[model samples]
Target chain A: MEKQDQILMKKQNKTYVLELIKNMAPISRMQISKNTKMSPTSITRIVGELQEQGFVKETKLVTSGVGRKATLLDVCGDVLFTIGVELDKAVLKIGIVNYVGGMIDLQTYVRNPLESYEETVQNINDKVKNIIEQNAIPVGKIIGLAVGLPGSIDYENGIVRVAEQLRWKDVHLVRDLSKLTSLNVVIDNELKMKIIAENTVGKAKDSKSSILVGIGSGIGSAILLNGEVHRGESNNAGEIGHTVIDPNGNVCSCGKFGCLCTYISEGAILADAKKMKDISSIDEVFVAFRDGESWALNILDRTATYIALAISNLACLYEPECIILSGNLIDKMPEMKQQIEEKCERYMWEPIKKNLHIVHSSLGSQGVVLGAAIQAQNSLFDIN
Target chain B: MEKQDQILMKKQNKTYVLELIKNMAPISRMQISKNTKMSPTSITRIVGELQEQGFVKETKLVTSGVGRKATLLDVCGDVLFTIGVELDKAVLKIGIVNYVGGMIDLQTYVRNPLESYEETVQNINDKVKNIIEQNAIPVGKIIGLAVGLPGSIDYENGIVRVAEQLRWKDVHLVRDLSKLTSLNVVIDNELKMKIIAENTVGKAKDSKSSILVGIGSGIGSAILLNGEVHRGESNNAGEIGHTVIDPNGNVCSCGKFGCLCTYISEGAILADAKKMKDISSIDEVFVAFRDGESWALNILDRTATYIALAISNLACLYEPECIILSGNLIDKMPEMKQQIEEKCERYMWEPIKKNLHIVHSSLGSQGVVLGAAIQAQNSLFDIN
Candidate 1:
């Protein structure tokens, strides 16, 4: 009844219409109206406003039954931009991503193994600013920047609760970044960010629910629920590596005994290799295993089985349509794919096994930065 | 532009408004408007129409601002009813539930352990019709019925994929029941239904996301995502029991090795007891443990450890705020609750350990029927 409420209602309707178009890219107004159950007039009005605001644009034409063409509207993918940074133990990656998850500018740099959280933030801030200037990116065009760290992060508050890989604890990452730069900042766990990226533009594009399992120095998994990564009560969900596999077998870095990571992480695999051979890295171990060395084969086979078991467990719990494997181990050891899938099939509940699809992460190393970028865009645009 | 489209939009908005009031319960129109961002006039019109349709009513008056009363709308809880039935091997339960998940009538009956699916369906149909008629429940006032079965069900098609406990496989339960009755039917796993009920009106009420782990003849768990049971790609999402704990352990009922259930299910405990002494049921095992028998205590302690590990793994994956234990084993042996919680706390990642809470299912035996009723109501109403 009130004037202010009517305006709010209009704004809400506009946001809904814009979101609908964004998700259903290259959509016709008729399709939008049908899906939203909105009147054609309302759809037209909202779309017109969106176009005028430079948020949407006419892109293509779809052939209709009558040999006529229906004009399609798409969210202007490059109209807004976001910066994504992935802070790993030995490497740092940055990308400027567009509204549609397109990377505009990207780079990776070697990370100082012993850099303090504050020093790392400062270096990252300088690089991001330099990149923006180099590319002549307009300050107003870029939304907030997002950082993905390898740790249990308080994503909502941008605090890293514990990053065992980075040896960082309770670091107020976003606040630190925000103080050093004008850009607003968002932060989340690296695996969580990777899953979001995969859901947006990779193997999980058609999946409303999926899981991404990362098996690098530390193992972790993240769930994508209806297109958003699930951040549970404390953003520590998907810490699967710490889940016990053999409660009495061996102690994990977290001081827990027989964690899943102890048997399957890249570090774990390397440690296994070092016990009998002069192998220094996972690549050497994988090479030895692929060439049919008995010791290496045994270790790889067991880890592959564990990975499959973990996938089966995740499938049963998350009921995900797709389980994607990422991180260094998966990227390097393509031979283990068949082994893991076979093992997962052997372990999975028969019904879930029938529905589950296991795959390699399509985004791979690019997922973290793109995911962080999209998350930043979401934060600035209130996209959800 | 068209009358049909206008009418469709009006109905959609009406459904939205009614669902808002139903979920918010005892909320004023002003609060609804504020939350939904609808114009007050639109809210009043929708509320008035819903009130006239007997879907909602003014049920409360809250004193506000100096001696004024603000009237609140509530869903007409009894205006619609649903029949909920839980089917297990030895016992069956039926409940007549109202719109707001309140139970009007509840009864339990003995079931033939070796009955055929068709025979079981026939008996249930006959009893359901008789109960409805005996209670003078009008056919029009009641929504379709829902059945909770102990199986991996193809919920969308109402087919039981596998139910090791019930010895069921690929039974067209819904079609068989629907063929015999005028009402449509919906079916899901018993654990999934229980979690829904608990999330709505039991121990999980305070939690937006929670897990209900039921330790009965078969160990099973279900997740509630924002008050709705998460049915994964094939409605077999929370098959945590079948998730492997040991690749070389013992074979489980589901033909898997070292399933979490092999360590914790009532059948497993009974089998363990049998391995030591002549014991027929889990009740005997619990009695032995309570009486300080080391054999029984050892079986229980191992199962409790596995149960705690399973809970810790689930918490890591699902990030559930609360984990609720259910079924007869937990219902009868309340002392195991503390031991399991302690074990889970010991194994959990520290951050999650601080955030997670373990509790017993408050609804206990009543969860299944009530949950099925609410699910049936959801199907008929499109409440989500």
Candidate 2:
């Protein structure tokens, strides 16, 4: 083998051993060798290197079948940390996340809807500094920062093409934030980030492939397959909001008539409620529905049907193991979940309806924040 | 490195070199080394082995910028052949396909809708024997056999879960066929195979990701991403026919209301036409439309609109680089393609519509056969 080939092989072996130890903690060196088919000398060398770097350590002693004791290896959970930020139209959430995707500390701030891109970047930078100082975290231990927002994100270059909710376009979010804090920054669509969190530690943790549907101000979905996001040609794979379901239905903000979002989105429901009884929020519509008002019942029932239709459509197209429902419409109106699932049973294709796990998001609002931090850690410390 | 690792590395290097030569033909060994970052000795050894195996041969000579002449390598296109079969309700198509996905010979036969699975298998076995004997081809050069049909295929296990058109359920097609002919058999959904052909050599050749929509007696779609079919949890990822578009619309055969297929499929159009006149086929409706019949025009116009709506919905959900329309509804009525494109222009989401290439299938009826043969070749000769 060439010298370069030998070096490459060693690096790969080290990464393999490290990942095995991290994922299968309290595993003996013999167990790693048995699972990986690696030689004992190679495992020992890699584990020693990982221990020297403080990423791994000896955990506990376990008895083998032959009555021999062996030390188990595990990853040091606090060796590295990441900053996750969720940037939305009305809120900015930041969290310090550890190696295991758990938040050490989280803070939420009310964001001005009309804030400029520059002002938002400055505010995020200041908050990040304050949080680090307040926690007294060592600077060297911070891996990077990841921001999740609603937009057509140029993930490779960290550019936001259009954020309808934030009314911002052509913002270089990653470059600006990285420059402000001197930390590596990554960005992705908020829904994509949320699905990653769901797949990692929430409702979709056991699903090999899953879809996360967010039906708030806009109706959108994100597909997670084998731990990777299926971002379509232009990071627009799950833009189901603009899909027309009724030709004669209401006009959507996207200039199409009878779009799926026009029937099921939170804004669309509120608009319908306002037309009926001068309602200002979706909660008022729910209250009226609970009070047995015909107008509210009509609006809510139709919305639930459309939501079901969207779920049916998603199931037909994705056929994922699970479909996770998230966003404001689902989170705030938990009572409507049953209505949507019942309608889904009526609308879904018979073959697909079987064995399909349609569940609500378990992480709720912290999904994006946790997902972004996990993504940041993954980006900074890739084993594959 | 272990002895086994050495052998594995050598095998991988051989496949890499063979693929490089196959994809970039008439390439010199020096250029291969430069592109692959492999030493000249390793490239020479692999190339030598490939030449000995009759898979590759030296072709024309090329001169570098320095005027140094070097012999280029090329694959032997006739080295291996595969049998491709397309099984449908009304017909069966069989072809002998070469290594480069070219059909050496093709034959078609009528199929009974209610034919038993065993009878179909026997028929296919006879056809394969006749084709091979007629060509006077040697048995050793034949790779395998692949069959594409309309249904949910358990591709890994080579079982047909359901073929609604053919009325087949739980048929062990691959096992039975292989047992009869002593050749490896693979099966996949016809649309999935069609899209594979489309991605390989048809309209979607340049598309990174694409969706194929088939509108006929039934409606279905297939997704191709990065050279692999996206078969979902149960090989039903693109079963878009049962997706509910209008809750108050007509009932679909799947017991759903207002399915996309109910408005656009050939049977749907024929059903609507028979309501006004005694028309029994879709071709008659097209003829009447061409002859300027008012009722015919109304039906065809609505069908075209629904076809456009399905395309728009596909575009919204997948955001693929292109969407290819296929099946009898599209192949027989070429004139409607323009009308559908016009409707798609009006209905598509503005952002996704801008760069999307909505095109008709270039392979037409031969797609499934060609793709099946290609898949057979890939399966029998996998080096990765």
lDDT of 2 at B48: 89
lDDT of each: 0.84, 0.86
* Model 1 chain A lDDT-worst window of ten: A375-384
Candidate 2 on A1-384: residue-level lDDT in tens?
999999888888888888788778889988999999998887888888888988889976684677678888888888889999999888899999988777999999999988988899999999999898898989888989999998788899889988888887888888889999999999999999888888778888867788999987678899887768888878888888888888777887777678887788767888778888876877898889889999988888888888898889989988988999998878888878999989888878877878698989978788899999988887877542
Residue pairs in collision within model 2: none
Report the C-alpha lDDT of model 1 over B287-350, residue by residue, as the tens digit. Answer: 8998999998888899888888888888888888899988888889889888988787677778
Q: What C-alpha lDDT, on a 0 to 100 scale, does residue A343 get in candidate 2?
A: 88
The CAPRI quality class of candidate 2 comes to medium
Clashes of 2: 0
- Write the residue-wise lDDT of candidate 1 on A1-384 in tens digits: 899999888888888988888888889988899998989999998898889878999986674677557898999887788999999988899889987788988999999879987889889999999889988889888888999888888877778889877889988888889889788999988887787778778888868888889988778898888877788888877888877777667887766777898898777888878998987878898788878999999998999888888888888888888888988888888888888877776777777877778889878688899989987877777531
Find the 10 residues in a row with the least total lDDT in model 1 chain B: B60-69
Residue A178, model 1: Cα distance from true site in angstroms: 2.6
- What does each candidate score in C-alpha RMSD? 5.3, 4.0
Q: How many residue pairs clash in each candidate?
A: 1, 0
